[model samples]
Structure formats: structure tokens, C-alpha cells
Target chain A: MHKKNKPIIVLLFLLPALVLFIGILIWPIIASVHHSLYQYPTFSDPGEFVGFKNYIDLFNKQYDFGKAVINALILAALSVFIQLPLALGLALMLGKGIKGERFYLSVYFTPVLISAVVIGMLWEKIYNPIYGIVVKGAAALNMSDVIPPEGLLGNPKTALLAVFIPTIWQYVGYHMLLMYAGIKGVSPELREAAMLDGATDGQVNRYVIIPIIKPIIKISIIFAITGSLKSYDLIKVFAKDAYDCSYKVPSLLLVRYAFHNAGGIASAIAVIMIIMCFGFAILVNWMFKERDLYGKK
Target chain B: MAKSNEISFDSEMYSVKKTNKFVSALIYVGLVVWLLIDLFPLYYLFTFSLKSTEEITGTNVIGLPKEWLWSNYLRVFKIGKKVGASQVRLFFANGGLERSFANSILVAGLTILICLVAALMATYAITRIVWKGAQTLNSIFMLGITIPMHVALYPIYVSFSKMGILKSYWSLIIPYAAFSLSMAIMVCTGFMNDIPKELDESACIDGCGTWGTFTNIICPLMKPALATMGIYIFLQCWNEFMFASVFSDEAHYTLPVFVSNLKGSNITDWGLVGAGLVLATFPMLLVYVFMSRKIQESFMVGAVKG
Candidate 1:
């Protein structure tokens, strides 16, 4: 309901959001690329331009960014292979018209609603070596040797798995809810038709229901992958220093360097993170599209 | 021949019913197992919060506390009192549990305010007005949904440090509002589309300027959408740990940051940290208990639209 040539009012309306968007998100990305190419010994002095040194230094033994990225990739793999399947199973089960469907849905989602910090702390107490349930239970069961004296989080061997368990536990409900919504949207006529052909529950879910929900599954995969790559909160709770930890991720290194006068290296890590997140997102989308076409044929 | 067919069909139905009952019974068992796994940790958090330090570290690992000591929760508020002339206390001086709780409310409140006003105006401009480049601007805002906040962290850290607001509320508020804008705008625009164009037309016919129409006609009808967006935004700001920890100091520490620091400063007090965690999570649990459906719906809306 506007007359022509009211550009001023439109600009006014859009300016605040656009400015915040660009300044906080867009400009930082551009600045990250620029800053990555320089050695910022400190923020005050944007020292001499050193082309790809910062990026290369990331792979050096000292930074070990390559390992961090690998760890993140492992987490992403776990989310897709382990976490997403569990979520889908739950969603499929709940979609079958259970008795307390709403109750189950809300209970499953309680973990996702709680902050990662709180979840991390809760898990930490559970993992506490001295009086933690893990040690106490192990002792009660006569398998005390399984846990190291320093605790699961203290040992590099088990720390990664220990940290990832709670992280995965917290978000399973999230993906389940997403897939559950998708399943709920499936028309009952389609299901009844499938059953009319004498298809069992497993077969209906595998062939009929899954094919209909591929797009949502694809979205969930993208989210799962991207979310894992940028995972920091829970992992941070386990690894306070970021360095000298087995469960290091890119964001941990990014934060450490950002405040430690290694801004160039931090910016490089940030740039790589942006690239990987966008890259995986595109890759997942394309892969799903290809499968859709193949299925049609 | 017809009687024989009916007899076979009856036998088949009986077997299917037996299998269905068995399968559903198995499914119920599985659902109950998962439900226990989900609720156990939360139950542990609450019970642990009421345990004494002695019980937490000694004889009582998993069971309920022998004698419930609510004093653990009281100690959570008195965190900074014992850090005498220590480096952690510099940041821990005013960094009590209560201070951080207030700080979190202020940061989250200001963020919601900023996002609502900015996103509402932007949604109006994009959906209602006939401006050149509106499509382009809308696309730019939409592009933000995919951009991870990590990309902006360091640069915003740099810029905010230079502006000398790195340790202030703006440090968290500005970025929180900015990061929240895309989803807020998306939800608003989605809702705004359903708002009939005739309302704006009638307002214009009644001599209402663009501003007048937005204030009088559109804002009131957008309440449900705004409420949905408000809860979503509140959760994001409240649970945010990264920027809150980095940008805010002891004086401005939010709940997540405060609870995290509680562990560090009070190393031996597991029960106290549990109390702090409970305090941090209590608001969210209350929200979940009351508006679990709305919270779930908000996330669903954002996901589908994104």
C-alpha cells in the first residue's frame, strides 16, 4: 500500500537490520579473509602481510588445526550415522499413533531445551572420577580397572568419546522432532494404501514413508553436519584450555587464538569454518537432489 | 467356496492381531527406556543441587542425599566472597550467581527488544512496501540463516574491543540481536504475508500514513507471531555461552558464563556448581513446562522456513 518514490521510508525501515546484519555478519566474513592474510601479533597492530603462512601454520605441529578439523568431522559422522538414525527410529515409532505421543515428544525434547553448559556440567558430575557415578558403578560391579585414576575426561584415550556422548545425547530429540513433524505431515491415505498392498510396518516406513520425507532428512543432515562442525559449548566444558586436549574442535582453537594475540591464525580458522560449513551444506543438498533423481529413474 | 474364504480371512486376522499387540508392547518398552534416559540427568541435577559437599564427594554418588542440604544453593550466590585477592576474583568480585542472573536478563531483554523492533520494521518494508531492491535486501537477510556465528566472532571481538564496549552489555547485545535478526525477520515475514493486504489498504484509505498503518493495524495482529519469536529469541540469548563468556567480564557475566566460572572458582564444591546449574536452568525448565508446545513449534517454524 505504497505510492511510488518513497525510497526514503523503505531505506529507513531496512537500515537497522541491514546495518546490524552487515556489520556483525557480512563485514566480519570479509574482514576475516583480509585479516587471515596478515600476521596480527596483536589487535592494535595489523602487522605485515604474510600470504598463506597463517593457513599453513594451522597444519604445523604446534597449531594442529588439521587434527581439530578431523575431530569435528568425526563428530559430524557420528551425528549422521548414529544420532540421526536413532532420531528417525523414534520419529517413526511416534508417528505410528502411540498412546502418549505428545508426552513422549516433550520428554524427548527436554534435553535440547536445556543449555549446553548445564548439560555439560551435569555430565561432568556424572564423569567425576572421585565420587562420580561412573567410578562408583564400576566399583560396585567390580570393573574398577576400566577407568583411569584421572577419570575419563582426564585420559586422552577416552576423553573424546566421553565428551561426545552427552553432546549426541542432547540433540537426538531435536532431529527426532524435525523428522517427527515431517512424518506427521504424511497423509494417512498414503499409509493405508501401502498397508492395503499387504506391506508391513517396516516395509511401509522403508519404502513409502522414507521417500516422502527425504527432503526433511536432507535438511536434518545439513543441520547435523553444520552443527557438529561448529560444535564448541559441550566440548569446551570438557576441554577448558582447548590445547592439550584430545577432543579439540576448530571453534576451540579459534577462541584461544582470538584472545591470545594470534588473531591471524584465529581468523584463518574462522574462514576455514565458514568455508566448510557452507561447503558441506551445499554438498549435502546436491547429494540429496541426485538421489531424488536416481530414485525417479 | 465363500464360506471357506471367510474362515481363512478370520484366521489371518487373529494372527495379525497377536503380532500387533506384541510389537506395540515392545515399542512401549523401548519408549519407556528412552524416556528414563532423557529424564535421569535432569533428575540428578535437581537432587545433586540439594546435596552437601560431603555427600556429593563421598558416600552418596547416585542415590538421593542422606540429609538434604539446601545450603549448597545458598553457597552458589556467595561465590565471589571467598576469593581473597586472587586473579580470578578480579573478574569474580561482582560475579556472584545473582549478579550474573540479572546480567543475563538485561542482555536477553535488550536483545529481544532490538530484534523485535528491527525485524518488524524490516519485515514490513520487505513484504508491504513497493521499493526497488526490496527483493535484493530480503535475499541478503535470508542468506544470513546459513552463516554460522563463528565467522563473525573474531571480527566482532576486534571491532568491539576497539570501540571499548567489549566488556559491556552491547558486546553481547549487538551481536545477539544481529544473529537473531534473520530468523526473526523470516518468521515475521511469513506471518506478515498471511495478514491480508486489505488491512493496509483500508488504513491507507482512512488517511493513515505508512507509519500509522504499521503501528495501528499491523503490530496488533502480529502478536502471536511476535510471541513465538520472543520465546525463540529469549532461549537463544539465555542459553548463549560463547559470546556471553568472551565479551562479558565478571560484572557482566551471563548465567551460562557464571555457572561455568562457578566450577573453576569453587573447584571442590560439586554440589554448589550443581546448584548454580539448576539456577541457570530453572527458567528454561519453567518455560518448557508451561510452553513446551510453543517452544517446539517455534523451532519447527524456523527449521521449515530455513
Candidate 2:
């Protein structure tokens, strides 16, 4: 019933979102790329064109972008190896038509609903050296000497791990829910057939259910990796204004540079983050697709 | 021989059943343990919020407050009050808790409104309209999902400062709504697909134009989707910190930034900080309680970077 010349109406409807998207999101990315190539001491100052000097300088001690990149990579590794496995285990268990399934699902998801700042603050209190539960528990167990005088978050060896603990904990339910939904989508007939073939529950999950939910698992891995790389709030909460901390991620540096008249460095960090996120996402997708092809062959 | 085989099968079945029970029991134990880990911090936060500074610092760290002091919450509310400042004067001060609460609500509310209206129209244009470049336009918006907002921070700051909207609420609202549009359009498109195209055709037959059809037909039908998207947008805007912190001044601080700064600016009043955390989380907790299923579904729709 609609003809072609109703273009005005379509344009009217699309204009607001398109303008906002281009202005706020797309154009700034272009601006960031442009800004990263120069000696942008401040937003207004657009200094001499440094030509990727900022990018190269990132690896130096001044910026230490390489270390932050490595820290973020370590977090991505932990998410894929440890966090995803735990989430998968919970997803598999919960997928088995468990009792109080809804209750468990909702309860597990509570942490995800709460703000990261709150989670970070809670952990800060929990790791407080003098009054924290961790120290108190250690003292109660006669392991007072084991815990350093400077608490878990204070110790260089443990601070990154300490910061990551809550970060990983907060999102286990998110990945679990994604996997749970995927598991639920597996036809019951498939499970029943496997059981009738004398397969135990573990065997069925290993050989049948796991294969069926591989796509979800792939997506989970991508999300886990990208999410870890983009992680800011929880880590920032733990490492407040301490730019020299061992647990610095790309984001902390980005914000610090943006404010400290180092716009070029900040833009360089932002570009690298975007690249790494897109890279990992594509890499995971490709890895999963290749494996699927091999399996099919 | 047949009878002997039958006996062996029966015994095997019995053992399998017994182990299944044990395994299920173990699963329950694991789930319960994780559940406690999940809930303990929140429980501790609530109890900690009510504890005296003495109890929190010295005697009881994890237990319920010896005396439930609701005054900690009141103290958090009365944060900006000085010895000489009048009540009404301090109430309007940026340091007061209520100002952040108002800021957060106004930012979140405007973000939700802008996202819904803009995304709804855009989704209709892409999904329902028979335009030549609709598919191209849709993919362009989808690309926004992959690009993290960090890349835009410096540029946004620059632009906002240049445009002189750096400290205004629009600084937050515009960017938030813009970023949220991708997810909103994604959700709206999903819902728009399920709505049979016949509605638009039938509406045309009934003498309704494009605007009339959207307003009278599609908008009403998209209510559930809109609500789900609104909630997601609300969660994002309310909990956002980095941009809110950078963009806004003291008087314009959102709840997350406010809660985060609460401990830093003061002389470490643990109870008051706890109270502020509770107050920051209360709205989200209420949303979770009432609309958990919708929230989960919303997460599923935008789960990848949500």
C-alpha cells in the first residue's frame, strides 16, 4: 500500500538516531584516530603532528601501555580459563531441570544487577587490613603471619588477583544465564535418546549437550574476553588515583591521560582498546568456526 | 542364564540410582555454596550500613550491628550540613546526598525517554519502511555495538567542552541516549519483526497514514519491548560512572559517582559510606525484585556488551 515517495517520512524517523549515532559514537572514533596521530597536549591545543609517536611511546615507561595491555590480557585469560569454566559448570548443572531453577537463576544474577562501584566498595571493606573480614578471618584461623601487614589489595603480588576476584565473580551469572538458555534450547528428545542409548548424564552432557551449546560457549568466550579487556569500574574502584599500581588497565590510563593534558596518549589507548576488542571478537569467532568445520568434516 | 543376566541388570540400575542421588546432592551443595558467596556481600553491606563506626572498626565486622543504628542513613542524607549552614541551604549544596539522587534520576529518566523515542522511530524506519538503504543503515547502527565507548571519551569531552555543554546534564544525556540507541533499536527491531506487517497494511486500509499507524498501532504494540529497553537504559545510566564523573561537576554527580566519592571525600565514616552504597543500590534492587524476568530477557537481547 505504501509507495516509494514516502522518503520524507522515513528520513524524518531515522534522522534523530542516525545523527546521534554519528555525532556521539561514529564521529568521535574518527576524531580519536585523528587526535592520536598528533601531539595533542590538550583538547583545544592540537599540537604538532607526531605521526604515531604516541603509539610507539605507549610501550615506553612513561606511558607503560604495554604493561596495561598485558594486565588486560591476563584478565582476558582468566575470564576465558577460570571464569568461563565455572560459569559453564553452573550452567550445565542448572540446565538439568533442577529444583527451584528460577530461584537459583535470579539469586545468581543479583550481583550482575548491582553496580560495579558497590561491588568494589564491598570488596574494599572486605579486604580492609585492619577491620576487613579477610584479616579477621585470617587472625581467627591463626594464619596472621601469612596475611601481609598491608592486606591483600595492598600487596603487589595479590592486588591484581584481589581486584580480579570480584570482577570475575560479578559476571559468572551473566555468562551462566546465557549458557543456561542455550542448554534449555537443546531438545529434550536429544537428551532422552542419549540416555536411552545407555549414556550417563555426564556422558550426555559431554558428548551431546556440550556440542549443541558450542555456539553459546563461543559467544560467551568472546564476551568474557572483550568484557575483561574493557573492565574499568571494579578495577578503578580498587586502584583509585594510583596510576603507578601494578594492576593498571587500559581504561585507567585512558582517563588519566585525558585529564592530565595528554590527549594524544589517551586517544592512543582508546584506539588500541577498540582494536583489541574487535580483534579478539573476530579471533574467537574464527577459532570456533574452524573447529566446527573440522568437526563436521 | 537369562535370569542371571536380568539380576545383573537390576543391580546395575540400583547402583546407578544411588549414585545419581549422591551426585544431585553434591550439585545442591555446590549451588548453595555459590549462592551464599553471591548473597553474603549484599547481606554484609546491609548489616554494615546499620553498624556503628565502633562496631565496624573494632569489634564486630561481619555480624549484625549490636544496636541497629538507622541514624547512619540519616547522617548520609545530611552530608553537606555544616555547623553554621542552615538546613535549606545545605539541602541545595552539591555535597548533599539528595542532589546526586536528583541528578541521577533526571539523567537516567531523560536518557530513557530519548532512547525510546529515537530508537522506536529508527527501528520502524529500518524494519517497516521500504527504503533502499534500510539494511545498510541497520548494519551501520549494529556496528556501534562492537565499538567500545572508551574510544569516544576524549573526543566527546573535547566536543562537549567546545560546544559549552561540558558541565550540563545534556553532556551525559546525549551520549548515554546515543550509545543506548544501538541496543534499543536492536530490541525494537526484534519486537517489530514479531508484529505482523498486516497491521500496517490494515491500518492503511482504515485510512491511517504512516505517523498515525506508528502512533496508534506500532507504538502501543511495542509497549513490552519499550519497557524492557527502558529498564536496560535505566540500569546503564544509573550505574554509569566514568563519563558521569568526567562530564559533570560536584552538583551534577550521579549516584554511582557520588557513592564512589563518598568514602574518599570524608574522614572514612564506614557506616555513612555503607549507607550511601545502600541508597545508591536501592533503586536497582527494587527494579530487580519486580522485573527480574524482564531484566534477564533484556540482558539476553543485548548480552554481548551489556
Candidate 3:
């Protein structure tokens, strides 16, 4: 709050949090972007500011930066596709009057309770070729001869996808809970009326339910997309020994660059990531402008 | 032929009419199947944590082991090695993850306590203070959610290091208190909105000051939201990997950092790792199981305000 005589008190209340946010968050973001201008040094400060050199380098696919960006986008898109649809399907199913719905919801959601590192380790051990569960299970099924010995995590072909699978799996119940809440809030009379008109289960879900829960869908998708883009911990843990520091999606990409590589380019990557996420968020919101569905219009 | 066709058609119609039961059963079956898929890895870890390494290697990964290693929990409490076993005092004691956990608790605890008080005071001003710029404060907080914490880590680290508090708890505690303000304020403001301004006015007219009025009137009414925010803040601090990872050393490692650190070479003690995970996850799970209903309701309440 601000006023002529009240400026001091107002500033007193406002200064601490805002000042820290600006000092710590905003300034670093600005500094991080600024840092991207220079040629990175080996063991010292940035040697000089070549105005667009790092940006040029990134654009020209120097250091495999372009690949990282593409990988990040694909990871986000893949996660959104997998996590949202499955979660939405579960949300719709459970939102139906299943007798033991809450129990199932909690049970399905237990994975979310554990740390990301643990999840990564568990899955990685399971995907270990020599002693992992999948290979052993295949051997047990007497199909070991038919399949290759390479496990998903070690195979470059399936490595990203293998990592992505758990990233998607972790959030299913979280998104399901969000979507279910949104679905539950919808008036059941609409569904009942649709059914009374001899509407099939498909028709009820398609015509009435989807329209009502569109915001939840958008919110869930936003989270899924953002989450996938920010998926670092799992991959970091899962790919512990084998993971090259630089070979990853952008969140980890930026991390590797900043921690191991210098700051300027990493800052650029960070800025680009924030923009990409916010841009995608805005686009989704624009696309799913469901005001009329919610009756606000 | 006509009589047989009629009989088949009637039976088919009867089956179709019972579709809800069929679908519900299918849903239950599908749910249980998915539950098995999702829970097996975690349940395996839990079971494995209770087993010795020998048992883990001998048995299938899916089930209970021959003997449960109940001592692993005790092992988690002590350091595997102490510095200079000839036992001289060192700059750091290489023992007691429980000590580091206590440090985390102290940092998170004090930070949250301060955050709650400060946010309560500031949020009151934003909602109840008859002045301009209130909207700006609120909007800044809403925008704060989108600003990634990593962006803030650099300056905070540099500044905290400059202040000679790099390895100290303040490195994390201050930033946490600072960064988590936006979330706390938003929730606090929302709770404040639900309590009508007339109560504040009446209290003011009766000679109560701002702090007194907040302490007496506003805080009590906001219990549900406060409880929700408390859990949110606790979880935020408890599971925080970044700030702790960057800021703290071995002496101050939070549970997340400890778990994150188990990825070191020669640290292939998956059994100990499993034990650590159970230790780290169980407290949060305990809170979740008891408070899931309230926590779920809290989100709905927040959505209404948003």
C-alpha cells in the first residue's frame, strides 16, 4: 500500500521481500542473461564480451546446444502427451461413481510421495542389463534368447524415453487428483440428463464432462509440460555413472553448463527456457479459453 | 429360429443393462492392476530396506526377504566413519545425519516461523491498509510463482558468501524465508479476504491496534488456511534440494541433499539407500495420510480465491 504521508510505513512493509526477490532473483536473471555475451573461460572469469558470440554459437549448434534445446522441447511434449491423457482418463473413470474411488486414488498416488532420487535409482537398477529386473523377468519368461541383453537406460535409442517414462509416471496421480477435483465439481445432473437421452458412456464423457473440466485439463497440462521441461533430478540420478554431464534436456543442460561450463551461455539457456515455458503456457491458455463453458461469459 | 433369436436378444439386453456393474468391476480390476504396477518398485524398496544385502541378492526383487534389517534405521542415525579415528577434533564431525537433519529442522523451523509472522503482518497491510500499491504487491506475488528459484540462487549464494554465512544455516534459512514469502503471503491474503473487513473496523474502533487486531481476530479465523500453508511450507523446506544442495555442506545436509548425494561412486549400497529413502519418505507420507482430506480441501479453497 502507498500514499503521500504513508510512504515510509508502506515501504517498510514492502521492502524486505521485494528487495530480496529483485536482488537475488531478478538481478541474477539479468546478470545470467548478460553473462551469455562472452566467450567462456576455462578456469577464470569470462575473458571478454563478444556481443553475440555465445548466442551465435548456440544457434550454429556449437557444443551441441541446439540438440539440447530440441531434446528439451521433445521431452516436454512427450510428457504432456503421456501424462495428461492417462491422467485425464483416470480422472474421468474415477469421477464416475466407483465405490472405492478414494482408496484407489491414494493407492495409485503413492509413488508421488517418495523423493525423485530414490525413484531414479529404483528404476535404473531395474533397467540394469546384467542384473536388472526387466532382463531377469524376460529370462524367466523363457524369452531371453528372443530379446537383446541391453536394458532401456543404457540403450541410447531408449535412454531418453526410458528416463521420460518415469518422469511421466511420477505425476500421473498428482494430475489425476487435480483433474478429478475439477471433474467432481461438475454438476452430475448434466451427465444424468445426457444419459437419460440414451447417451452412451462415450457420449456422456465426450459431450458434457470434457467441456466442464477444461480448466483443470489446462492446469494439469501446464504442470505436466512444465514438469517435463524441468525434469532434472530423475535423469541426474538414473544416469549417474553413464550420464555425460552435458547430454540432457535443457533444465539439466543449463545446470551442467552452469556448474561445469561457464555462466553466460548457461544463463542464455535459462532465459530461453523460462521464455519457452511461459510462452507455451500462454499459448495453451489462449487455445483453451473456456470462459463460456464455465459460464463466466 | 425366431423363438431362439428372441431369447438371445433379451439376454443380451439384460447384459447391457448391467453395464454399470460390469464397468465398475472393470474399473476396480484395472485400478488394482495399475496399483500393483505402481506400488511394486516402492514396496520392493521398502521390503529390501528391511533385508540384508545377502538376502537382497538371494531373493527376487518383488517380495519379503528372509531376515529384516531393522538395524539399518539405527545405522542411518550414525556416521559410517568418523574423522581421524585416532579421534581428534576436526572442523567438521563426520557423523550423525541426524545432526544435519536437526540443522535442517532448525533452519526450516525458524525460517517458517519468521515467514509466517512477517507474511501475516505484510498481508494484513496489503488487504486492510487503505492505500495504493496493494494490487502491485499482490501481483508481484502471483508472478513470483513463475520466476524459477535457480535464477535467484546465484546472487543469494554470492551475497550470503560475502556475508560470511556460506556454510552456515543462514545461507539457506534467509533465502528460504525470503523466497517462500510470496506463497505464504498469497495464502495469507486469501484467508484475510474471507474474514470481512467490518471485523477489523470494529476492532479498530474499540482501540485495538493493527497487531492486536490481527493477533486477536484475523489469525484465529485463518486457521485452516494457516494449517494448509504450514504444511506447504514444511514440505517445501523438507524436500528442497536446490537451495540446500548449493548452500549447505556435509554438516548441514538436508534429507534431500543426503539422498541426492547417495549417487557417489562406490556408494552402491542400494540397501542403505533404500533405508534412507524409507526414513526420508515416511514422515511426509505420515503427514499426507493424516491430512490428505484437509490438504485436498485446501487446494479447492485456494482455487476459489484465485
lDDT by residue (tens digit), candidate 2, A70-110: 88999999889999999999989988877898899998988
Query: What CAPRI grade goes to candidate 3?
Result: acceptable
What's the TM-score of every candidate structure? 0.92, 0.93, 0.87
Give the fraction of reference interface contacts each candidate recovers: 0.65, 0.65, 0.27
Find the number of clashing residue pairs for candidate 3. 3
The TM-score ranking, best first, is 2, 1, 3
Candidate 1 residues B1-306, lDDT tens each? 122223223335433322277888888998999999998888888888888878777767667988888888877766755556565554446777766878888998999999999999999999999767888888789878778887788889888889899899999999999999999999999999999999999889899999999999999999988888988898889889899888887788888898787667776777788888888888778869898989998788777655
In angstroms, give how far residue A202 of model 2 lies from its true place.
Answer: 1.2
All candidates: CA RMSD (Å): 5.2, 5.0, 6.6
A71-186: candidate 3 lDDT, tens digit per residue: 66778788677777888888888887567877887766767666676688777767767656677788789987644557777666677777877776677887777877777777
**lDDT: which candidate is best?**
1
User: What is the C-alpha lDDT profile of model 1 across A1-297, one tens digit per residue?
Assistant: 345548878888888988899899899999999999999999888999999999999999999999999999998998999999999999999987778999999999988888898888888888988878888889999999999988998888888788778977799999999898888878776766676677788888999999998988998998999999999888888776888888899999999999888999999999999999989988887788744555851
Model-by-model DockQ, in order: 0.54, 0.54, 0.35
- Alpha-carbon runs more than 4 Å astray in model 2: A1-4, A290-297, B1-19, B81-91, B304-306
Docking class of 1: medium
For model 2, what is the alpha-carbon lDDT of residue B301? 65
Q: Over the stretch B131-248, how does candidate 3's per-residue lDDT look in tens digits? A: 7778886787766555666655544554576678988787887777766777778888887887898998899899886667778998888777777776666666776676787788
lDDT over C-alpha atoms for residue A267 of model 1: 96
Give one digit per residue, the lDDT tens place, for model 2 in B46-160: 9989998889887888888999989989888876545467778776676567888888889999999998999999999999988789999898898787788777889999988
Off by over 4 Å in 1: A1-4, A290-297, B1-19, B81-93
Q: Which wins on DockQ, candidate 2 or candidate 3?
A: 2
- Tell me how far the alpha carbon of residue A213 in candidate 1 is from the true structure, in angstroms, after superposition: 2.3
